[model samples]
Target: MADPVPALVATGVAHTFGETRALDGVSLTVGARERVALLGRNGSGKTTLLRVASTQLRPDAGRVEVAGADVVGQPDVVRRHLGVVFQSPALDPALTAREALRLQAALVRIDRAEVAGRVADALADAGLADRAGDRVGTFSGGMVRRLDLARGLLHRPTLALLDEPTTGLDVLARDAFWAALDRRRADGAQVVATHAMDEAARCDRVVIVDAGRVVADGTPDALTSALGPDALWLDTDDADALAATLRGEGHDARAVVDRVLVVSPSARDLVAPFYARPDVRALSIQPPTLADVFAAVVGGRGGR
Candidate 1:
């Protein structure tokens, strides 16, 4: 038997804004029921890629398939399989939560008879039932995002494209947002674009983009396990002596402030002997972190 069709497929996708190459031959896939997080710096092409896959913007090159429908030639069919929540706020300020949801259902061509029920269920799922009649303009940032997500799900699309969905949410609101997302895990596949590592940690896999190319892609544990920029740290008043001693011991060690950092693959072998020293104040091993992976892959500029 042939392999089943993937939930989403983008191959050699490329796009440009004037001379700036927004997406350059990028490719990705999300399997059924899988959650993939797209992470990168401020202008690293995450948004452009999402826009292309969601069928909101046509790419200059390559192909995208959403639920086995072509994004370029069968855009309407692709829309039937996609629900996107953009980074920017796109809700109308004047419409109440209920009114906005009703409009969304109509826009998505939901049956008129089912629109009311679907809207009610979406709002309730988003925890907006108590404030269904309130204008969206009066809601907090988190509340607005929740309502936006509710509108996205009203049509029951098979693939969800979320771009920075929890960028500015507070702790409690962020938790609520993830709770809503968790409820949909068994129903469809999700492609979440985010900067929060904690959120990425919850995803089944992560794909990091930079300069319009995919720099790294893997599960969090898998990426973290790969040997990289891993460091063995040593703290002591005699930083120079420690560095010299480690070098004499054939370890590539360097001093930063009052500590020596060892980055070689053999750093772990020195742990036992270092702790045996009387002057060794403290020792800690930092496994390769997601940030470290980003830095190593994306030109050493870390964070987000």
Candidate 2:
């Protein structure tokens, strides 16, 4: 038998905003029930790709399909199969939690008979059944985010496109949102655009984008493994300068955020020079992580 179609597919997708090329020849595929992270720093085209895949923005070049429906040619069809939760809150402050979901169901054209049942299920799934009659404005940031996620699921889409769904949420709130999302979307595929390394680490696959291009794609462990077994970290006053110095000396080193990271097979042996440096404040060694892989791939720029 022939293979089943993927939940999402993008080929040579390119999009430009004026002079800034947001997505440059990007391509990727998400299998059924797979959770893939569109991992990148800000301005890395993660959101652009999501928008294109969701059919909110057409690409300048290339093609995108959601559940075999062409995003451009059959955008309405794609919309039916896609559940999108954007970074911004779409809830109305004056509307009650139940009202918000009811509106969403109407907007999506859910049958009147099913709307009540679906709304009830959504409210319960969001843990907002008790607050169904309460105004959305009265809810916390986490509650509002959860409602938004619930709204996205009214259609039971085949693919979920999440663009930094927990951007301003606290750690606990972020965890709760993911739990709710996991419970609701377990049977569907997910493409989440986020800059959080920890979030990307939890995904089945990570597609790292930089400068509108896909720099790397692999499982988090597999991607980090390419950096070798160990990573040496150097805390210095001038991470960029120290990174440049190390690079000049032929070390595969780069400055990530506030530290200079060196990934090599013999990570311990290369730490002596930094350990003796007056400007170097601390030194440590650990297994390679996604951040280290990002530093190496993006050339030390755009740290999480």
Candidate 3:
């Protein structure tokens, strides 16, 4: 079979603001039906890249295509084929949820007769159908975010770009947002920019960016595996003493907190010996998490 065309593509993309280089030679491609998480620290150019891909901002150098149309040269064509949910709330306070979606459909030149049905579908898809007639200003932050998503889907674009879509949401709200994306991915492609490790793990693939460059890219499991082995966390009154003892016994151990010692993955096989010690208390082994993988990639504790 022929290789599927990319739904979104960026090549040698570079952007600068004053003296700071926001993006430097960054490139990425998302295949049809692919779900990719763009993981990065603050100011890593993830948002800049998303803006370029969505045709909201033009890159200083390089090519960006959304569903095969050049973002710079054919912005309107690209916009018509892409949906964007920005970090900020884009809904107007005065407009009702249904009205907001209606306005989006009209602005996108969706068929007048089809606008109502499309707006209804979009609201339902975002799980905001019950609030369709409520004004946006009265909605909670999560509700407002959902409305933004509903508006973005008004045109049924082939590619969806979500910039920190779950920011500021509580755990329940965040889960709801992910569930909506899960449903959308069942039928199309999505590129999510997120700092939440758990959220990043939900994507089919994750690309880690730091200092305006791609540092790691892979499935969550693959990235975590590179960190060596599962980590063991032990909380004890004498964490330093325990670490010294473990080190003396040839176990790779380091103190993460005054009372907590994080041991190397290899220590799992040797944990029984430590657990048997009367002085050690509260010892547990955890599988490598995306945060651990991110820390290994970015060379420090992962940022929010």
Name the best candidate (by TM-score): 2
Clashes (backbone N, CA, C under 3 Å), per candidate, total 0, 0, 0
For candidate 3, report its TM-score: 0.82
Model 1 poorest 10 in a row by lDDT: 295-304
For candidate 1, the per-residue lDDT at 266 reads: 67
lDDT of each: 0.84, 0.89, 0.81
TM-score of each: 0.83, 0.91, 0.82
Error of 2 at 195 (Å): 1.0
Cα lDDT over the full model 2: 0.89
Of the two candidates 1 and 2, the one with more favorable lDDT, higher being better, is 2
lDDT of 1 by residue, 1-304 (tens): 8866788999999999998898989999999779999988788999998889888899999999998999999999999888888887678989999999998888889999998899889889999999999999999999999899888877887899999998888999999988998887877899999877888889999999988888889999888776444567788888778878878987766665567666667667778988888878999887767765554466433322
| TM-score attained by model 2 | 0.91
Scored by lDDT, the top model is: 2
Candidate 3 local lDDT, residue 269: 75
